[model samples]
Target: MVLPTFVLSAALATSVAAYDTLLNFHGAPEVETRTIDDIHKAAVAEGGVVTLWHGGDEKTQQDALKEAFEKRFPGMTLNLTVDISKYIDGDIDRQLSQGNVYVDSVILQTLQDYPRWDQEGALLRYKPLDFDKIHPGFRDVWASWYAVVVFGWTNIWNTEKVSEGPVEYSDFLKPEYKDKLVFTYPNDDDAVLYAFDLAMQQNGYSWFENLLAQNPRWVRGTATPTTVMAQANNSYAVTFTGALGLAPTAPFNVSIPKNGFFVTWGQRAAILKDAPHKEGAKLLHNFLLSEEYQSPNNTGMWSVRKDIPAPAGFPELMDVNSTNPIDFERFMADRERVERLKLFFESKIGSAQGLSPLVDDL
Candidate 1:
């Protein structure tokens, strides 16, 4: 029996409406009802492929995540692409506007883009398993997006070169540290910029001027400064971002500021509404939030889940006196203020030079 084209269209619209009615707009189920095995079955039925555009300076950053996901679900495949979050977010916007979104999910440092995309109705509203266990500030009320990892920046120094490490931002400006400091260009990364802004606010603009007199080597990415210091090329560095457990040993040691604040933000992740493999994306999301992956031992950093403890040797995020995750989200949302600060920092330090850390492989 062949139905008329209008009848088919009407029936399809009705089906979509019926599906939409199943979802609650306000305070729905906090935890996902479906188990990981159930999601895996559905994903396999849908061809079992998930393509994710992860945000990072190096492609190898997500290797462990991809490996874990594929291993946990034997038939499932994860196609991962890693790049700087700023560029990846722009690409996502373009893809969405063109109605050609190819990626199923994105995990990015660009916190503001998630809310904007949700408003545009471009994000899926499915809550992953153990959603209730996630930190309230890290997950969306509507389940449109949530953070899977907590990332931050703090001070680090070469233990071999510096007998006394910095306890506060001002310590870097001391005479002994002169010609020994290396730092990422604050204007180049918003997280680093916010950290520097906090320092400026606490110590005043004159502090920056004094530090400038210290002759710090300027670099592009947050990781570069730490890498430079680990190589014994510099004695001090800031913006030691990413997994805390991965901090360099022997020659280097990370320092949390005792007097002033450092910056931390959840690396937000979301599934696109128009994704080609929705089931696969859902499976991947649930896997990320699962206990096996969120374990501090697996990630080497803080988990988004409140029930999970911080990695060894690190205090729980709330126990830290000098850092606030919510503040970073608010900071990213204010574009005008962020732009002004970026420009102001550029004026003081000059523009970032050389190729991006992501450019080497691509």
Candidate 2:
């Protein structure tokens, strides 16, 4: 039964395509239930170590996670690498393509990458304990990825410098706020760009032109703007991105917009299909979703689990005025539109300058 080489190749291609389609539709089968102790024991037998690539502005941002994980799983070691989400996602792609993946799992802000990676069969489809308890919008139907924490952006100001903080996008254009505003360069961060896009949609392009006239200081990451405000170097800033419950309230106040929407999204986490320490990765994911880790007192942010109440003094995500978590997910899915918005904002704010916030140490 000799077959032509061309025919063989065609058959193989079709088989591969079919397999990918199946994966896209149903994903990998779910793993059996395992306690954290059971997973930790298996992980220790495999390698006793797990490498995680965490997306954030600075290495210190993940210090808490690292410390907590080590304490919770005594025998297992967690190697944490912190970098900008954009850079980490590209690095993960390169690693996967080269078949040399080093990271066992990822906790990232780039929500769009998870589904694409799942389609490529790059994610392990293991649902952690309590997977069924996660908020509906925060977890995938296929169990490929889920949100470990919720993040958002709003206005913040130094109370001593500005007696009254801006309550809406239009308030930034006032004469009182001129030369007193700091902003993250929307071109440099998709989240910041999305926030800016919402502002323009509500206030119009003319509002942006007027904002430029205010002579606001521009920086590379959302955290930098909050830093500027805290130092009183700027009287006000937009897009104060941080864990909602953790934001300082002393000399500064973080405010949700009185009119129009602010931005919020679940920061997603997943285990890599080719993880070197598969058991360890599973343990990490499970721990992240566990109640002990997701407690409001511990994370200082809204829990992705529906049963957990919102942090004290903060309303449930749904009750918040003029905000939608799903909108940010939709925004990230449209790459072409996001790129266009980036360029448009760059034209108004100028290119982002200085070292990346990940390495800037500021």
Question: What is the number of backbone collisions in each predicted candidate, taken in the order shown?
Answer: 0, 0
Error of model 1, residue 350, in angstroms: 0.6
lDDT of 2 by residue, 53-76 (tens): 988886788889889999988888
In model 2, the worst 10-residue window by lDDT is: 237-246
Candidates' C-alpha lDDT:
0.82, 0.82
Best by TM-score: 2
Model 1 stretches astray by more than 4 angstroms:
1-31, 232-243, 246-248, 360-362
Can you give the TM-score per candidate against the true fold? 0.87, 0.91
Candidate 2: misplaced stretches above 4 Å? 1-7, 14-28, 232-249
RMSD of each: 5.9, 2.8
Clashing pairs in 1: none
Cα lDDT tens digits for candidate 1, 1-362: 99999999999887655344334343342346787899899999999899999988766888988898999998999999998999999999999868899999999999999988876768888888888889999989889899998888766766777777787888878888888888778888888888888999999999989989999888777667666766644355443342345344676667777789988888999999899999999999998988888887777667889999887787888777888887898999898999999999899899987689776432
TM-score of 2: 0.91
